[model samples]
Target: MTKVLLAGESWMTHSIHVKGFDSFTTSAYHEGGTEMIAAMRAAGLDVTYQPAHIAADHFPLSAEALAAYDVVILSDIGANTLLMPDRTFARSEPTPNRLRLIADFVKGGGGLLMVGGYLTFQGIEGKAAYAGTPVDDVLPVALMTRDDRSERPEGVVPAIVNGAHPVMAGLTEWPTFLGYNRSMLREDATLLAEVDGDPFIAVRTVGSGRSAIFASDCGPHWGPPAFLAWPGYGPLWANLCNWLAG
Candidate 1:
């Protein structure tokens, strides 16, 4: 069975609330990959999840380590997390560049996919900072330099560019997505889907491997309940994995 590694989509958040001279602060841990994992599992694939916190310490440090999985997905996690691992940042010890390992993994025929979020692509305030990274070079599209987010609380529907594509085989017209990162497709990549002229779903063949990009969240907020509930959601991701893993 094809195995997949999913990283990110889990976070610890701290918030402050103040009203009429009353102030309070609280912290919470949240995960958004439940639906994505479910969708992949439903698609008949084996998945291993690495939350943001764990990814910092456990994300593969070398291509050989990454070889444990057939497909790797990066979602809602910043480059810094992988670049500055605990061993490197906290221990002040030199470490292998995970970003380079990921690049080599894909180039050596392993599957890769990048899902968008505030900490993905050229994220909020450009803090995600993947623009010039090795991973970015292997992506099917080019990320923007500044913040690439497109906020559409009103929802923007995706247009299927090639329903004949394997990933779009069972998918018809897709439901609306709240928002997504605006990315430009590479000349060699195939545009599978789009939203308001921005690249929403794209794919490409990199070296002996395959890669794709879903410039939108797979869960809440951008995905919302309605989008996740869409009948095509599960199959959409399943096919993506199947194709990449091939």
Candidate 2:
């Protein structure tokens, strides 16, 4: 059984009765982290889910407590949630950062997978800016900016780049994704899948550990239902977990 740690915002309350386009009360939508955990567990992997409800003050503590899992999944959360007041750009020179700690964890042999959302990788309006952070160095691809998100109303078609990679083994084409965070890739990165000439899925090796970045959301509202209903979902995520653990 592979032990995995998942962290991200869980408690979200939307404001109600906002005038025109935004007329509704505080409602909670299912998050991606929980969805991934369920998929992993259904594949027989032992998963430990740690959701950061009020993330603004809980991420640093959660990052520091990630030693127990074989892999870590960061979904729908951004940089500001992990930055302590003292570590903000206004106060320090960006030394001894939490992002660095995550990089070090991977370098010291930890697996990591980052999923996309409105708050991931230079997210909408530059929310979860990860370009210059230590997390960027460990990723197989390059993140351009958070505001560069791509919305595919007709959804995207994914094509496998390396069918032989362990993470991709036993899998064919994946289901269409509704949207994704746009990102550039480093020369050393391996492109796994693409959509309209853009890289949709990618992976890279960092020291003894490995990391993968799926630029699309794995949750229901963002990804196709086939991702969870199809037979391939189990093996797809299983392969990812096994590769990351190695």
Candidate 3:
């Protein structure tokens, strides 16, 4: 089985509840990668999901630790989470740069995939902030310095530019996505699919490894219920994971 380590796609929200007389705060947690994870596992891939907070402290900081998986996925997570662990952030202790470790892992023959979301690639208000990081350097597309999300509440259709690519295998039709990140395709990268003429799915070979980017969320918001219900949904993710593991 292809071993995959998926990080991010989870978040906590705190809201203030005000009733004319008083106000109280409430907090809730949510995850967005449930469907995607199930799909990969159903396809026989060994998947380990690390929510944003958990990943912030536990994501591999060494190449040897990362080597345990064939593919590493970053989805809906910002750079700061991985860049600053408890030791580094609270104790002011030096730690290995996790972003560089991921980049090096890919170059050493591991696969890397980044799934888009509100906190993925130069996300909302540019809070994701992955523009010039080492992770950005190995991606098949170039991220924008500012907020890159192109909100399409009206929805947009994705066009498969390279349907023949293995990553798109068994995928014929696609459901509309609410929105996606807009990115520039690299010269050597393969544009497998696109939305609004911008890269939606792209891949590239980096040294002895491979990397791919899905400019839209894998589950909600961008990937609406209609998309998650699409028959090809499972196969699409399965294909991407398998192709990357290759």
Better of 1 and 3 by TM-score: 3
TM-scores, all candidates, are 0.97, 0.85, 0.98
Off by over 4 Å in 3: none
Error of 1 at 14 (Å): 1.4
* Weakest lDDT window of 10 consecutive positions for candidate 2: 55-64
Candidate achieving higher lDDT, 1 or 2: 1
Model 1 RMSD vs true structure: 1.1
Query: Candidate 1, residues 31-118: lDDT per residue as tens digits?
Result: 9989889989977899999999899999988777899999999999999999998888989999999888988899999999999899
The per-model lDDT (C-alpha) reads 0.91, 0.74, 0.93
Q: Report the C-alpha displacement of residue 42, candidate 2, in angstroms.
A: 2.0
List runs of model 2 lying over 4 Å from the truth.
9-11, 18-30, 54-64, 85-96
Highest TM-score scorer: 3
- Clashing residue pairs in candidate 3 are none
Off by over 4 Å in 1: 19-21
